[model samples]
Target: MNRKQEETETPSKYMNQMIRQQQKQLLRLLRKAGVMPDERIEVRDSELLIGLFSQIRRLPEFAEDKKKAAMLMHAMDTIFKFPVSRATVQKIYYRNKDF
Candidate 1:
C-alpha cells in the first residue's frame, strides 16, 4: 500500500494490539482475583470487564479484600493508561460511583 494507506492502517493496527494486550492483562487480573476460572481465560467484552471491576470496587469488603482490591485497582489503572478520552473516564467513574 501507499504511504497514505500505511499511515491510516498503522493506528488501527496499534489499537488492535493494545486492546489485545489489555484484554490479556485483564484476564490475568481476573484470574488472580479468583473471579474467573484459573484453568482458562475467556475473551470477554470490555464492557463486561469494566462492569466486573465496578462491582469489585463497590464490594462492602473492599477495604478488607486486599487481593481483590489490588486487582481491581490494577485493572482500572491499566484501562486508564490507554488513550481514552477524559470524558470517557469520567463517564466510567460516574457510572461506577464507588470508584
Candidate 2:
C-alpha cells in the first residue's frame, strides 16, 4: 500500500483485518486438528459483535421497541469480559462503519 493509503486507513479498520486473518488461521489449524471449527468461538472478535448488533439494530422488532434494546445491551455485556471496559466496547460500537 502507498503512504497515502496507509495514512487514510483507520486503526480500527486495520485491526479488524488483522483479527480476521488470525481467525482464518485458527480455523485452518482447527481443521488440521480434526476439530469442529463451528463448535468453537475461542476469540471474541469485536468486529463480529458490532456486525451482529448492526444487523439486530436494523430489525423492525429491535428498532421499534425500547424493551428490545435491552436485549442488545445484555448481549454486549455477555460478549465482553473483564479487562475490556464498557467504554472500550462503546468506542468500538459507536465508531464510524464506513469501512
Candidate 3:
C-alpha cells in the first residue's frame, strides 16, 4: 500500500463500509432510533448482517405486544432505549422482595 492509502484507508475498512451501505439502507431511517454501528469488520455480506442484527435488544414488531403501558410517558416511552411497561418495571423489584 502507498503512503497515501495507508494514512487514509485500508482495503478491509473500505469493504466493510461498502457492505454496510448496501444492505438495510433505504428502510433504516424508518426504524425507531435506528443506530449505525461504530465498528466495522471485514466480512462477507451475510456475516456483516449477522453482526448488525445480533446486538439488537428487542423482539421483532410482530412478536411484541403493541399495547401501550398503563402509565404512558406522553408520546415517548423508551427508558434508556428499551421498551418496558410499569408492570415490567415492577418485576425488576420482585427479585428483591422474593423470599
lDDT of 2 by residue, 59-79 (tens): 698779856766686566554
* Candidate 1 vs candidate 2, lDDT winner: 2
Top candidate, metric TM-score: 2
Compare candidates 1 and 2 on TM-score and give the better one.
2
Task: Arrange candidates by lDDT, descending.
Answer: 2, 1, 3
| Model 1: per-residue Cα lDDT over 4-90, one tens digit each | 868876556667799879989998999899998655233335445555676766678875676666676665755444344535543
**Among all candidates shown, the one with the greatest lDDT:** 2
Model 2 worst lDDT window (10 residues): 36-45
TM-score (all chains, Cα) for each model: 0.31, 0.40, 0.18
Which residue pairs of candidate 1 clash? Answer: none
Alpha-carbon lDDT, every model: 0.61, 0.63, 0.38
> Candidate 2, 58: how far from true, in Å?
1.9
Tell me the spans in candidate 2 whose CA falls farther than 4 Å from its real position.
Answer: 1-42, 79-83, 94-99
Q: How far is candidate 1 from the true structure (C-alpha RMSD, Å)?
A: 13.1
